[model samples]
Every structure is written in structure tokens, then in C-alpha cells.
Target: MSESVIPRPSGAQQGRRFSLGPALLFCPGSRPDRFSKAAERSDAVIVDLEDAVVPGEKEQARQNVVQALNWEEPGLDPATTLVRVNTASSGELDADLDALAGTELGHLVVPKCESVEELDALAERLPGVGIIPQIETPRGVLEAERLAHHEAVVALFWGTEDLIAGLGGVTARRPNGTPRGVIGHIRHTVLLTAAACGIPAIDTICGALADSQRLAVESEDAAAEGFIAKACVHPNQVATVRRAYTPEDADVEWAKALIAAFEQEAGLAMDEGRHAEPTVVGAFSFRDEMIDAPVVLQAQRVLSRYDATRQR
Candidate 1:
């Protein structure tokens, strides 16, 4: 959890395209009835085999997930499928993997990933599957960069609820609902580490399921802070998450204009209304903001993402 304790990430592995979806919904693996509906509603349906399932229902939940995979629902697609398995510490982890063995699962979400040894073993076991290790422990935070560079890890999701519990805290948020100090800091650590390792960083799920306005604020914060996606606990959160991930129409237009301006000329003086000290790149004025290299690159990604979503 200490900034000084962070380690450097290592290398890449057998890669698969990790979708830049906005909402990664966790449909309880025990509820097969909700599986196809959640898949259709969410950008990625993360069939959860942990937390939501009781111990007595664990095996049944595993079987349900496996059976749901074979479901011929119109919205079911392997590319949007992510299976959140039990942690290595859990006695049920092996069983979870066994349930999906030899199946072409697009992604595996391994929860409570605190040990690199467990990651290495999972990588070996699920060779071609894109792995997303959820970071929720103190050990996981310190070794995040190391985990990010793991050959199997495609993205990292910061599980704030478990993280707060692990840290012996009550909540990951303030009374007004913004992320608390330590949790917010750790969230940033996970974000930066994932970015440095060239992988997507998923923000923690918003706990206020009924508060759509608050969810929008939190999702906006996540997207503005460079998170590729937000986790969803319910179907209602999906639309807001997607909206947050996708650039607003005005933002998209601004990004397009900025990109066009950059393509036209490389000058440090194109301000009409916008003002900046000028960071020595193209200084096109855009709503009173500087148009530097980073800004330009951000615009490019925004438009690129918009195009990608439209195609999908």
C-alpha cells in the first residue's frame, strides 16, 4: 500500500483483445436465468462465481456458468464473456477453472489476486485466456506493477469493497460517496500501474445501486481519471457506465476539431478564446484550454473509441 513499495512490471504474454467496454456487469453465477439478460444489457457479462454465491451453492454456480455458456441466447457471445473465478486461496478456485476447462472463454477474472505464484500457475493452466486479476489486498497493491506485467494479465480491476475489508475499514467512500483517502490512492496506484504496463485499468464498482446520478458522477470520475471501464453490480448501472466511458457529443466534437487542427499545422499560437501558458506544442484554442500533445493524443483515442463502438 506504500508508494515506495511499488515494484516494476515485467513482460507481456499470449494476448487476446480485451474489449474497452464501459460496464463489466457481474451476474451471479448461481442465477442462470439472469445470465443472458445481463449479457444483453451489459458490455461484458462477468459471470461471478465468487462473493455472490454462497458456499453451499458454489459448485452448483460453477455448473450453472458452464451450462449458460452453451445457451444459444441471441446476446450471448464469447467475446463479451468474463468469468470471475474464486481466488487461489479459496479451495474452490481449482473447481472454478475445471468448470470452464477446454472451453474457449474470452476472459477470466481472478478475484483477490495477492500472490504472483498463483498468477503464474493460472497462466500455465489457462494459456490463451485473457486474465484480469482483481486487486483488493495490501499485498496486491504493492505488487500491482508486477502483476500487471504478468504474462496472463490483460487488465486489473480494483475491488474497493474487499480492499476496504482487507484494510479493516468500513467504507471505500466518504459519507457523500467519493472514494476515501486510502482507497482512492490505491485505486490510482492500480490505474497508473496498469497504464504503464499497457493494459486497461477497471475502476471499482459503485455501491449505490439505486443512485443513478451518483453513479454517473463516479463513472465520470473513473473515465476522467483514465479508467477504461467501471464495474456494475446491477443492470441499471450499465447504461450510465457506458455513457461515462463514451465521450460526450460536445467532447467528441472538440476532440475531432483538435485532431483536425493538429493535422493542419504544428504551431504554438492558435488561440482565439482559450488561454494557456503554452506547453510548446500546437497551441490551438479550444474552450479556453491548451491543446498540447497529450491533449491531442487523448482526442485521438476518444474518436477512435467512438468509431470502434459505432462499428460494434
Candidate 2:
């Protein structure tokens, strides 16, 4: 089946704002049926063809993605589909993009992105395609600000495992306990870049699937640190990722209250009904900054997704 490109934003609003999804889809090759199940559960589907695909099976892996994209389903939205193409400088990168271009994938994630020249190559090759540049090396982290500003880049990703490996284990510990110390540093870099460019900063996957409790803790830590979403390797990890990325009910309520109070106060007011004293500037500082916007909106989005999935 021929591939199809995802829907692009209107020209008027192009490059001005990015709509970040709730989760980063991590597709590690398993079986076709396994992919189907994972796709259903994942908020975004990333058809990976890099590290996850064995060298000999790269072609077969490409074919699998092609076939899967053509398969009929209850009805899948192409907007949520992403294909993780090999890095632009890699030998297989061209073939990867050629095979999947024009398809219904929302973005092409370039692995090991370290320079603007590589991004320029990717942009030339895949015009109109969104890019998710994975910062998996020391160079990539250092070049993050430039990459974030790249014309095709819509988001930034931190690859913890590969990055630590690239750093020659300088900050890497046993690799079993927690990647937090290492990831924390890179995440801050990526987060700052994303914030400066107004793009989404995605957190790397916490590879502790066996222990759901631990996964939950790390996932929450990433979210609290300002990562918009996280990637997941296992189906069981999806719920944890979603929960971590979403705001709690209490947080949502507080946000709603802030919005209401701010609306009623018009930035400043004397709450005679609640208190005799006047509520002056900085009293509703949180609302002024729109920090609570995500909390309220994310809670609503999560509940809506639950309802939609339940109905299906």
C-alpha cells in the first residue's frame, strides 16, 4: 500500500505553536499482532526501525510497518501515528524515509541528531514532515538549542540509555538502580531548549517495567520536572505513562478554582464575601502565569480519552 502524509496545520498558524500529545509511543519490534495491541493502547504510535530492528531484519521490519499501516481497523487517526526513521546521516535513513514517506505518520523521529546540517538534510529529504530529534549523545545534548530551532523540528526527545552509553559511562552508575541522575541533567538541557523554542520536551522511557511502583515514581518525577510526556516499551507501562503525564484531580480542581477566582477578580478585587481585606497583585500569581492551564486541560483530556475508549 502507498503511504500518506499527516495533516499539517493551517498556513496562518504554521510554526507558531505546537500541539503536544500526552504520550510518546515507543515501538520495539515484537510481532505484528503485538504491534496491533500496543497501537490500540498507545496514545501515539511510533513505528520504530532503528535500534529495535535487527540489522538483518531492517527490510523485514520496514515491510511490517508498511503492512501494518495498511491494515483495516475500527478506524485509526493518522494524526497520532509516528515513524521513527533512522538518523539522517545513517546509511539506512534514506531507505527508511522513502519506504514510509507519504504515509499517515504524524512525525519522523531522527535518532542521534547532533547538528543543524543533519537536520538540513532531513528537511531537504522529507519536506513538510515534522521532526522529533532524539538527543542521545553528548553532542546532541550540547546542540539541543540549535536543533530545537530547526525548521522541521516540532519536539525534542532525550534518549537516556544511548546518551549515557555515549558519555562513556561517565555519569552512568550500575544502570539498574535509577537513570534519574544522568537523565536529570540531559532532561534539563532538553527542557530548556524546548521551552525557549516553545516545543514539547519529551522524557525518556524509564526501563523498570517489572516494577510498576518504581515506574510510577520515576514517571511522576519526569512530569513534575516539566516533561510533557514519556515513552513506553511495554503495554502495561502505558497506563503508568499516561497517569504520570496527566494532572491529578486535586490539581485540576485547584486550577479550576484559580481560573474562576481570577476571572471574578479581574486581576485584583476585594473579596468582601470571603474576606474583608483586599486581594492585591501576586495574590493570584499562579493564574496570571497560566501555569494551571495544562492541569485543568490535561485532566479533562484524560477523562475524555477514558470515556472514548470505554465507549469503543
Candidate 3:
């Protein structure tokens, strides 16, 4: 997609910032009773109004969400609570928006998002709401860059099962449970596109509820690849996702030591009356590895993740 096709946020929109914690748990909108529990269990709760609810229950689901928003006690936090609306083509988005209008909810997860025009229309109806576009189809993956740049988009999430289903594939994973090659490609494409647009990317949910070990491995891979968060289908998966995203104790110490060493080296350079370049001026050895600007930046990222997890 060309840069011109991507619309920039307005000045007011540009000033707004949205972020979610590392673990986001999904709760069916039809099951309002579980909303509070889901919120308590995960860092953020996504009340799913789309696939989670059958067509017959969609209206009831919408009403349930509205009722939950109106509750005085144990109300959903506008910051951490998100609603996953149906696709624009589903014929239910209009009703979804109508139900959500004038509510305190400020965030939405738009499923099957494949175009900027769709987002533009949604933003027009619900002004000031942040959107996390869920890319699942081939067109969505190809147009991810354009979708990521939309002003309403606060983050990007890709769905593996839907993508595979859309492509007429039998499964997204191999018999051994590792993701198929196409799934990996789509995941990386969405991740890189979101990163390029300076927004967070939410990893797909782990459907295998009983396979905690696989979920941990996948969550670790997502974190290693720079995904800010992972979506969970069940409450039990939340802690595993959080643990994978959080930096290890050894990693935190190593990052701190590396940063200190770089600062010391830079100090010595300045004391010698040498000017430091925008990047690191020279390379040095750290823990038997050649340390450079990139290495220092990686260390800084580790510390940043560590700090974010601590604050959460």
C-alpha cells in the first residue's frame, strides 16, 4: 500500500495514547456474569461480541455489554476493558455501534478489518474511540500497513484460526502443535507492520486450552519477536502469557549491568575530550560479546519491559 492511502490522525487524535497490559483475556459478551471475574483474572478483559456470541444471541450480547457499562459497582474499567465488535460485513456492526454509543467504553477490537475506509466509517459513528483492528484474512494481512496507520487503530491483532479457515486450510498448526509456515509468515507480517506504524501488536489466542506448555512457548516467541501482548481464550492462560512477557531476573540484571557499562564507557570518552556520536562511538566487549549501539538498545528494551511488568 502507498503512504498516501494511509490517513494520519488529527492533531487532537495524535495527542491521544492507548496501551493495554501484557495479558488480555476474552469473555463472551453473552456471559456478563463472567465479566468481573475475567477482569480480575487478567490485566485486560475483552468482552467478545463477535464470534463468541451466536447470531441469535448477538442482540442480547450487545445489551449485556451496555448493562455492564452502566453498573456502578464492579464496573468495567474504560482503560482496561475492550469490546470486540463484529466485522463490518456481518450486518451487526451498526447495531453494535448503536449500543456502544454514548457509553463510557473507549476501546474496540474490530475483527476482519481489511480497509481504511471501513475504519473511517466506524470512527465517524463513534468518535474518539480507540480501535484494535483484528486482521485475519489474506486481504487484511496484505493491507495491514494501511490499517495500522488508521487514526482509530490503537493496536493490531491477527487471528490464526480465521486466517487458516479463510484460506481453506485444514489447520494452522502441524501435528506436533507448532504453527504452520503460513501462520508464522502472517504473524510476522502483522507484527512488523504494527511496529512500523508505532503501535502495539497483540498475538493470537491459544485455542488449545489444555496445552499450557505450548501456550508458554508461543507466548515466549511472541514476546521475543516484540509483541506487546497476547490474547487469552481462557483465564488460566493469562498468568502464562504474563510470565512469558515479563523479563527474567537474570535478564534484568544483565540489562542493568550492560547499561551501566555503556554509560561508564561514554563517560570516559567524554573525559578524554572525545565527542560521542549519535550512535555509540566505539565498540567494547561485554560478557564475551561485542557490544555496540544495537546491543545497548536491546539491553534498554529489556529493562523497559522489566520496568513495565513491575509497574503493572
Give the number of the best model, judged by lDDT.
3
Please report how far candidate 1 places residue 17 from its true position, in Å.
3.8
Against the reference, the lDDT scores of all candidates come to 0.78, 0.67, 0.84
* Residues 152-175 of candidate 2: C-alpha lDDT, one tens digit per residue: 888888787778788777654354
Per-model TM-score versus the true fold: 0.84, 0.77, 0.86
lDDT of 1 by residue, 169-259 (tens): 9878888878889987998899889888888888888888778889999899988888878899999898888877777788788876776
**Any residue pairs clashing in model 1, and if so which?**
274-288
Q: Return whichever of 1 and 3 wins on TM-score.
A: 3
Q: What digit string (tens of lDDT, one per residue) describes model 3 on residues 11-60?
A: 22442355476899999998988989999999899999999999999999
Look at candidate 1 and tell me the lDDT of residue 192.
88
Candidate with more favorable, higher lDDT: 2 or 3: 3
lDDT over C-alpha atoms for residue 92 of model 1: 92
RMSD of each: 7.8, 6.9, 6.0
What's the true lDDT of residue 289 in model 1? 76
Worst 10 residues of 1 by lDDT: 271-280
